[model samples]
Target: MSQTRSSAVFGKRKEPHTIIIAHGDDIRHFTVRPWMAALCGSVLAAIAIGYLLATSYLVLRDDLIGATVARQARLQQAYEDRISALRTQVDRITSRQLLDQRLMESKVAELLDRQEELSERNGRMLPLLEKAAGASAGSADIPIPSAKPEVRADIAPANAYAASAVTNSAVAALARITKGSTAGKAGSASIADRADLMFLTINKSLREIESRQLEKIRTLTENAYKTADTIVAALESAGLEIDATYGSSDAGGPLVPVTGAESFDSEVEELDEALSKLDSVRDAATKMPIANPAPGRVVTSGFGVRRDPLIGKPAFHAGIDFRASIGLPVHATGTGTVSKAGWNGGYGRMVEIDHGDGLTTRFAHLSEIKVTEGQAIEVGQLLGLAGSSGRSTGPHIHYEIRRDDKPLNPVKFLKAGKAIGTLL
Candidate 1:
């Protein structure tokens, strides 16, 4: 009986419990099973555990955030490294481009400098070229492009304009190339190559111009020397020795020894020397009394022993008489200063000119005296009218050429005048 009672207690302990609640006239009852109680306890335990887990998550939240941020930072660093690498590659390419552009620019600049130098040289040589062209006007071998008679009066304008055009073209080409380069255009290398070719062409053109100028100058120099030599020979033929130092008597300068390689300046100096020699010889020829005193006149009286027309006797005739009509113009034969322009003892209305180097010319038996004493005279200037004055027969004039008061034959002088005229 005690064992049964203990088993009943154990069964009842495992059975559901009933609880009742009453209010005034209403009553309600609920049966709570042992499983329900266990479920409730389990639910309560689950809630407590969830709360503890939530609290732990809240405590470690900052660490988790830090970890996530660290990962993001690493990713960002990797991305930044990649970007830097790309930028480095771009910079290298840019650097190479810059180097190439600079090299091209330097080459172009060098070419420009050379062109400018050539232009300056041309500017300085223009006057000389023009002078040479004028001196050698009939020369055909010299290829002076700008030496035209119509334009010879002004050659500088055309040449200067052409040079300016070339410079402008070069500047335009440079601008185009620079613009393309700045715009990062393609085919920059080809542009630079074209620029080089164009610049080379310009340089070649300038060289050709210079070559033509040099050729002209050379021809002119040769012709000037030839002219000088011919004049000297003519003077020697006329019994006049050309003084070597005729033009250098008053010239004085420092004796700077020539010490340089042959160049354009040296060539120009040689040309100047040749021209100077030509001028000196020409001056000497001019002072010689070798021109005809009275052209187109018949010589009635001769020099040396001649029969005098008035005296009807053999007399020493110091000059030749030309048959002329009264009031006919008489001209001076050479350039000189008149020393006598009055009537002399035997010569009437005599006009005597003192040419340099002891040379004198006399025109006598003139009806009129057109010059005064101590008057400067030139060749072909009218001296007086021809007529029969003193010791003259009919209408005749006596012309004389003397050296140091000694009479010389005028025939040889007139012949020399013809020869000199042909040469000049």
Candidate 2:
């Protein structure tokens, strides 16, 4: 009978009693197809998997973006720092270069100023130096002092002496007249005669004194003229164009017409001015490069302390010795005045040049003297022929440099040879 009742369950279940399995308040349907359940489970599983994947993807993307941003920021900062460092380095280099350039410019300007100052000084001193040289060369032409005419008390030498004799004769006549007269007459005559004689004697004596004073004045005037003439001659020899004039006067009792003390003071002032100019010239010359005596690269001796070749002892070698042929031409090291151009004790035929500023140069042991004393010479000009003169053992040029009477090494002055050659 239960089987017959179960037969209706296929299409419709008429019995109203519904059996429902419930989890909490939810009902469970058992009629669902297995394929549908399986499909639904699969859909839910796919949805869960998709949600998890999406969350993971978002998180990874955020991390990657943050890392990229951080890396970009670091790179930007590094680039900025590098730019700043490069800018700083560039600025420092530019500043240093500028400083060096300015320094060089300043040095050049200073040198130019010094050169100008020296040139002005040379212009002033050259004339005075020439005058001195000329005076030194021809001092024999000066005239000797002349003896003055003598004036005697009783007898006169010239017109004044004759006048004095006449005055004595008049005095004797007055004495005779007084002796011949009587007591009262003689007294009056003697008094008048004596007065007349006294006047004549006084006039004669005054005339003699005045004449002597005039002669002395004339002599002094002549002497002053001669001295001025000598000075003018010396100046001419020193290559100076000087206009000199002499004036004399025989007035004011035996007054000698002379170049006054004030004139001498003026000359001293001129000398001081010239000396100052010379100092400036010398300073300028020191800064400039000088020429060399020898042309070739061969140098036999150097300036400074060395073992003496002759004595084999330590000594201060003041000059540079250049080995050359006997007749080799020696040149002036700088522009200067030939101060001494003759033989010396140990230097043989030597030449000394004053190159301003107390700087002097000497060329010794010369076979020939090309330049004369007081001659103005230029650098690289032929001076003389080299020879084994003085205490030398071979044909060479003994060149010495001096400053303010003290010897200095010639090599130091010759260092400007290269630059000098280029300039020339």
Candidate 3:
């Protein structure tokens, strides 16, 4: 084999590597270089290493991805928590601001309600104030509210409410109504203070109004008393006693201690009491027989001891004689029912009227009696025709006023009528 290999190499150094394989009917020779075989082995080893590395990477990929995802989730949760905390703080602040706004609005609304109440009270006091003002302006002549009550006619409570002036509180409340809840943080306190001041002013005005109204009511009550006293004096001067009463009341109840603004309400209550009392007095006075029976009449015979015309001697005159033409109408002196419309022995064709409170009047010397017995008559109504009848000196109406069957002087009532134009 060596002698053949050397002889083959000496003849040709370019030796082709060969492999001879024998088959049943064929023989084939294959040749390859050492470098080629090394190349094939190196390729196979690289492929095997690459396959193992790929399989290992596949096995670790899920765990690596899971760790990364978990870390990211933790970071995301932290960020979300921070964001939520911030949002909560903002919400809390907003809620607090909303609560403040609600409180402010509630305060404003309460103030408005108080202003409205004060305004309503002011309205209710207007008529009394007007009456008082008018009466005061007209008269230093009229001594007091009770002296000449005719100036202030009986006014209805409904007519009492009228606008005299727009108060500061009312204006402020009206302005605040348009500026609802728009106040800034610093402005909110300022608004509240201003509202309080306005409320104070309103309360002050109400107090003043109540005071004035109470004064007027006092005046009215005093006037009523004066009028009643005057009437009583007039009746007493004529020896007539009528049942009457003037009350002196002491107020007592649950004593509530008032302070600061609360006194305004108390004053208002007093004013209401005064008004009620004045109203009651007016009602009572309206029913009394305190007016003149004859207006624009000439008194010929005074009520006192006078010379009897028939006897021509000194005699006591029970009544005043009003000289009038025969057939002239004679008026009733007071409101009453006709008790007798027939002739008496001394007073022929006389018409007698029985006034309330045990009071009566006689129209004597009448040609004809217009009012029948049991017929109701008002003061100044035509009772009969004046004529010279039995016990009459001439054609005249012998007007007699009697209380409890006792004759009273008619001059006092006539003077009262002159003093009070309305009663006349």
Q: How do all models score by TM-score?
A: 0.63, 0.33, 0.58
Deviation from native of the Cα of residue 319 in model 3, angstroms: 0.9
- Candidate that beats the other on TM-score, 2 or 3, i.e. the better one: 3
Give the lDDT ranking, best first. 1, 3, 2
Write one digit per residue (lDDT tens) for candidate 3, span 34-102.
788789999999999999999988999999899999999999999999999999967765664576556
Q: Compare candidates 1 and 3 on lDDT and give the better one.
A: 1
Better of 1 and 2 by lDDT: 1
What CA RMSD would you report for each candidate? 9.5, 45.5, 10.2
Among all windows of 10 consecutive residues in model 1, the one with the lowest summed lDDT is: 1-10
Model 1 lDDT at residue 145: 39
**Compared with the true structure, what per-residue lDDT tens digits does model 2 show for residues 1-424?**
0111445458644333334578998976445445776899999999999999999989799898999999999999999999999999677655644543454344334434433433443344345444333222222244545465322211212333344454455445544543433333335445445545554554556445434534433433333344444433432342322333323335577755445334333443454453343333333443332567887837888888899888899988888888888999998877889999989977899999998767788999998999999898887789999998787778898988887878875554565344223212
Q: Which candidate is the best by lDDT?
A: 1
- lDDT of predicted model 3: 0.63
Would you give me the overall lDDT of model 2? 0.59
What's model 1's lDDT at 243? 83
